[model samples]
Target chain A: MKHAAPTRTLLALYTAMVAFVLIAPTVVVIPLSFTDKASLTFPPSGWSTRWYENFFNDPAWTAAFGNSLTVALIVTVVATAAGTAAAVGVSKWSRKRMAKAAQMFLLAPIVVPSIILAIGVYAIFLRLQLLGTLPGFVLAHSVLAVPFVLVSVSAALAGFDDRLTTAAASLGADRWTTFRRVMLPLILPGVVSGALFAFVTSFDEVVLSIFIKSPYLETLPVKMYASVTRDTDPTIAAAATMIMLLTTVIIAVGLLSMRRKKIA
Target chain B: MPDKTPGAGTRIDVKNVTKRYAKSTAVDDVSLSIEPGEFITLLGPSGSGKTTTLNLIAGFTELTHGSIEIDGQRVDHVPAHKRGLGVVFQHYALFPHMTVAENIAFPLQQRKTPKAAQAALVASVLQTVGLAGYQDRFPKELSGGQQQRVAFARAMVFNPRALLMDEPLGALDKNLREKLQLEIKRIHQDVGRTFVFVTHDQEEALILSDRIAIFNNGRIEQVGTSADLYERPASLFVARFMGESTVFKAQVSSNGSDWHMDFHGSTLHGPVTSTVPGKGALVLRPEQLRVAESRADAPAGSAAVPVQVIQNIYLGSGHKYELRLPDGSTGIVRTPLTERTSLRPGDSAYVHWPAHQGVLLEDNDLVSTT
Candidate 1:
């Protein structure tokens, strides 16, 4: 094997360090989940399944996990449906002056800061008496999720001919049927990816969840934050480990299913 | 597809339809009735609105004015899918996610045909398009021609009212294009469905269409059978567009029944086909021009328009030479190229043609520089 150059060696060293800086926290949580000692730190004296035991014994951690899954699933379903419709509507705009103006408005969610959107959503939720409710939290998460759906669905629409939809309609497919059989199956990859992004966004949401969530309505991330703030607990790390594993499994399933579908 | 097109008889009346793209009129007011079971080709160059007219009929693009009726029912307000028409795009938009079988079954499935009947219909169409066993293959696995066959099978699956094809064979290679063109014609005869095909290729339109609507600037310049359009083109644009024609200016001195063309310091005689008697151009096809050793061997009253050969290209059976007249009028002439040839570059010769061979066209500024 060829030896790396001196400058390249330095670059490789820095790259490895940067990766460690980003990945170290997540990696630390994994080991801390199994730490014999009840603390969040690396290089413990001895390793045991003590924290893993804490994870299973505590009902708070399990309920948080359940809440996070419920909210994320609802958000993913709602956002994907709404975003696909909005994208399909926008895609039909004729290449004209008015169409451009309308398109920019639909894509505004992506251009504006998420924190700004979160603040606005919280304000609206407070007025509607929806704050601290799971539905409100799901809706708030969907704002962020919808943008991903838009991006993916738009990408799929770009590759499709508008005539195909019309052709479907001409073939005696009603509007809903045409969307189901022709447009949906044709753009399935984009729609599936959109749902994936929606799930991921809602599942990992922290900032917005903290603003809108009540003590009882707290998601896994919110509960973990509260537990960490109250005092040191290695159970938080175990809970984090479980959440990451769950997310990974879901993403892997969606991707593998998509691949197999394409092959078929 | 057969659903909209009755097997016995039908006529598609496109009554005064016009489509506009914002301020630009891509397709001006155009109206023509396609006879039942006839294959009509909309022939024009790019931006001539031939494809736009097809889209209007297919309901892909809504018309700004007028209406379209198939066998006498107004279809202008009908959405594309509800129009019950089959369309084949130029790029062959086969659903990439579906297998050839699934693609063919799509329209039938949309119609909710029984699954068993759908399988048989798809199978028959596959065999008809010569892809019986390739049904399981995705569009990507097939070549351009094979994918085109799949597209054809999908379009005909539901047997809609008519087949609207937008330059369907454009993406295929030369040999495949001709073969597919013949296949499409054979299918047309077998199914006896009306087809409104769009294309810019003149040869394709000539070979395929029973009648061709020659479109120009979003309007129908001429609509006739291939023979009628080729032999009796009314407009100079139609004459120049349909096929190659050599044109030279002629001054008309009278409006008599036997109007004469005073051209190139020679008087060429032809009937006065024009009622608006004035200065015109005498257009003659290259095949109409002939070369003789001398005037002694020429026919009587043959207008010997003197020309000098500037360049000669020997093309096996014949020689094509760019002939330059003294008045700077230039045209290409094709004649038999043999060892007995008497013409060469810089050689002076007289150009002669039959009187009826000359067509009088208005001296417009639209002479194509291309």
Candidate 2:
């Protein structure tokens, strides 16, 4: 076996160093979250799980956590259904020009600045008198999450062999039966991965949540933001750690399922 | 394996069917009547409308004009799903997620067959396709040939009125394809169903079909039994497509029932009569033409043309001698290895064939690029 050259090794070390610098804040916060001291200090004194207990015992934190989970669940269901349908429709468009245009329009949320999108959504929700409601947050988050689902489902659709549908039709299956038996199973992984992505997008979203949040209806991110600005509480680090852990688990499951599908 | 499903074979009538795209016609004014229990092959090159004609009959594509009838009932307006035609695509199109048993049972399930009946039918189909114990293997787990067998089983399990195959064996290796071709022939014989097969392979068509329809440029040039198309092709295209042959340009003249053609300068008489006087092509199959040492040794009354050999190719069972004709055109002749004649490149010889063996195609040139 041949070892890498010195220059290549240096380049790899540089990339790892850059990655560490980018994620340093999160790494520091995790350990601080376990600190026994009252203030947010890393490697300070002994370690404890007091902040985690604080997160679990407090009613405000628990309410924010519940609110975030509910909104993310709603967004995941709405976005996956609408986005998967849109992907199938877009994949079926005969005219290349129309399909390309529709794809660009559907993916506009990903390219637009988040703050501008938040303000625009806030304005629309206000006019609809849904600003502080659960539906408003769910709808607003779904707007951002839909693009991820659409992209994931579209990628799956790209590799689909349409002749199976024709074969199913010829074999005495109606259109709906063909979709349910053949098309759905083939693209299920894409639909599932897209739904997970939509969930994660809604759960960690803060910019839009900040704009639409009411005092009575705060998501985890909005509450964390308020805690950081109002008080120098270390419990914010615990909240960040929990959100990170949730996203990590979701992503890990998504990757594992995708790998299993590939192997199968 | 017994096929208990009713109505295995159905007569299909395609009356002047035409399918036109915006830019060009895929199938144009084509008509063919396929008998029940007959295996008819649509043979042509890619983009020559053979597959399009199959699709039209299968109701996958709507006809631009004319009608199609299945078992004497018009079905041009029926959708593909309601047509109940068994179609096997070139790529197999097996559902990757389904086990072989489930795939074969799909049509039965759709028609609401009882679970016990579906299981029994799937088992029977698996046995019929020679994959009796592969019930739980998914499509992705099977080899290409096994997948194709599963596809055939799925298409046949439902006992559709007619089976339409579009280049089903095009993807396999040569040995596997030949093996599967024999399997298909056996299955067709056992089932006794009408099969409309499409392929670009002339040899496969000749070997497997009772009748072969040769398509060229969106139209069927000719449709007949393998021997009919091979021996008495109606047009220049059919003669060129069916097999290898050498052509000579000649001028036709007739005396009532007898006909004679004037080659470059030599005159030859044939048993068939020519109704008109004009230039036509004299098609001679390589097997019919023999190489003689001299014009004097050639068969009496046979058309003999002197040529010089360009190359001799050893073909295991025989030898093929490529020659340059008197008119400076190329010709090929296949001779058995047992023949005593010794020929080599640059050797001078006369190629002779009986007058009755040559076919005169009117208004045809000796060569065609299409």
Candidate 3:
């Protein structure tokens, strides 16, 4: 039962303050979601579940939520599979400088400004006549999501002993069997976390969603933006709070699994 | 633990195997003919291609040129998995998520052995490695030495053709390393399987190998028994690598029946193995050379040179004296503690060796001082 030193206590307090500042916007929306009033105001005169009800009752809000969920699920699957494969290939095959340069090029979507990427994607989708389609949004979101998955899986691969695969092969396991038995299990945590990151990135994406949204097809973030601009709807607060909750749960799951891995 | 043979031994013939990277050669045209149940150690300094040769033999690395045959069947083109060989790496490389039994059962599972047979084999191997009750423990739960035993058990449980170990005990502490060295030797003897061990430790090579292949600059310098290498080295490199020696750079002068070299105005005679020589190094082992206070005390016909003792290091059983010869070159002489008086630093002494013990290697600088 040793007390913490003053410097350690101060450091903890400073970190808490910074974290509160960062999460203040999301925390504000959570309280507003339960306000009795129709306006988005803090410390409401009375508290009620009206905004949550408003979010559930409106067809537009429900449709937007449904669209976001479907798109994010599709993006997570597509991006995780493709990105994990790419990360493995980069780690195994790209041992030379030119191939490594090619790997960096493939990860460019994560580094480029999203507004610029939105412009480019919008132009391409316009000519392809995929502007308002689900596939178009899924494709754009997957491109943005691929880099997060790639980075995560690649870091995991770096820690993974390629010698394990060699050892497997020497033990009479074929290439496919070695990959299935040795490589996949060791890197599954990375793949899962990458999938979660991909889902969150796609769910919260606003710039690309705005660029490609049709009048009939609005994702949750796009719908929230419209509500914030067109009306001070408290239901938008409920949507934001729900979106934040989803991401927090996903990230917490990732962190907890990582901690368990360290302990194990 | 006892002499229980589990698998048939393999005769590996590496015929002129060569491996090249983009910028350099990892292994040159090296060939070795290993018997069915012989333990051969590939001994060299790091980057001398000992491990590369082992990898090539294990079918882990593809040969740039040449071929290999196992049991008289050409296997140069076979993939590592199909070769049915066992390889133990420097690091244990144990699968952390697997239990000890599962790790040992991996090869049996791969070969589609029945579940009951797999369990029996895993249990037997666990006992063989002296980890009988530790089957349920994961690799992460074990100590470094325990993990190493698990790795060794996993590799040998399959009972493949030959076991290739690449510095397997390099990461362990001294005591554990010595203990495992004996374990590995006992296991090799009990199983009667061909073992190709790669290690940079000369003492380990001497202790374990029936024959040691000395590698230098991607080529096998010499291959012989420890006594053969110690008593008669083929090259200056082998002589220096096998054990400690003081080298004398001199010109050989022969008179039909006798050979001699003039060192610091004293003409010393020795038997000549090589007649055609320009400049050669006369290599004398520390035990072969004796240090005496007076020149008259040196043996008759022995090569004698005056040396100034620089440092005297007492190594419990003996004293090692670092000396500077009159010509500015350095040398070391070891004297048994019971046989001689301890010489102090800066004392003048005569270093002499028997006439027939000096081996002349032609102009090869074996040791790089830098």
Top lDDT: which candidate number? Answer: 2
Candidate 2, B280-347: lDDT as tens digits: 67777888888887899887888888889898888988888788876777888898888547778899
Chain A TM-score of model 1 versus the true structure?
0.87
DockQ ranking of the models: 2, 3, 1
Cα lDDT of model 3 by residue, B1-370, tens digit: 2135644578999899899998999999999999888899999999999999998988888999999999999999999999988889888988877899989999989889899989988999898899999999999899999999999999898887888999999999999999999999999989999999999999999999999999999999999999989988888889889989887776777876667777667676676556636666777888888888878988777778888989888899988878897668788889888757557899998898877777777656645331
Clashes per candidate, residues 3 or more apart or on different chains: 10, 0, 0
What is the lDDT for A164 in model 3? 89
Model 2 spans with C-alpha error above 4 angstroms? A1-12, A34-54, B1-8, B251-260, B269-277, B310-322, B332-345, B363-370
For model 3, the interface Cα RMSD in angstroms equals 0.8
What C-alpha lDDT do the candidate models reach, one value each?
Answer: 0.82, 0.88, 0.88
- TM-score of each prediction: 0.90, 0.90, 0.87
Candidate 2, residues A1-264: lDDT per residue as tens digits? 565799789988999999999999777888988888888876768898999999999999999999999999999999999999999999989898999999999999999999999999899888998887899999999999999999999999888999999999998999889988999889988999999999999999999999999988989999999999998789999999999989999989898988898887
DockQ value of candidate 2: 0.75
lDDT score for residue A3 of model 1: 59
**Candidate 3 on A1-264: residue-level lDDT in tens?**
555799789988999999999988769888888888889778877899988888899999999999999999999999999999989888888357865886788789988999999999999999999897899999999999998899899989989989888888888889888878889898988988999999999999999999999988989999999999999888988889899888999899888988798776
lDDT of candidate 1 over B133-247, digit per residue (tens): 9989988999999999988888888887788899998988999999999999998888888889999999999989999999999999899998777777767778878887777
TM-score of chain B of each: 0.92, 0.94, 0.94
lDDT of 1 by residue, A1-264 (tens): 665699789989999999999989877778777778867778766788877777777888778888998999999999999999988888886665766676677668778876887788788888998888988988888887888898899998988776666656656678898788778987888999889989998998888788898867889898888889997888888888887887888889888998887677
Task: Give DockQ per model, in order.
Answer: 0.59, 0.75, 0.70
| Native A-B contacts reproduced, model 1 | 0.74
After superposition, which runs of candidate 3 have C-alpha atoms over 4 Å from their true positions?
A1-21, A35-51, A93-100, A215-217, A226-233, B1-7, B255-258, B270-275, B287-354, B366-370
Which CAPRI level is candidate 1? medium
Q: Which scores greater on DockQ, model 1 or model 3?
A: 3
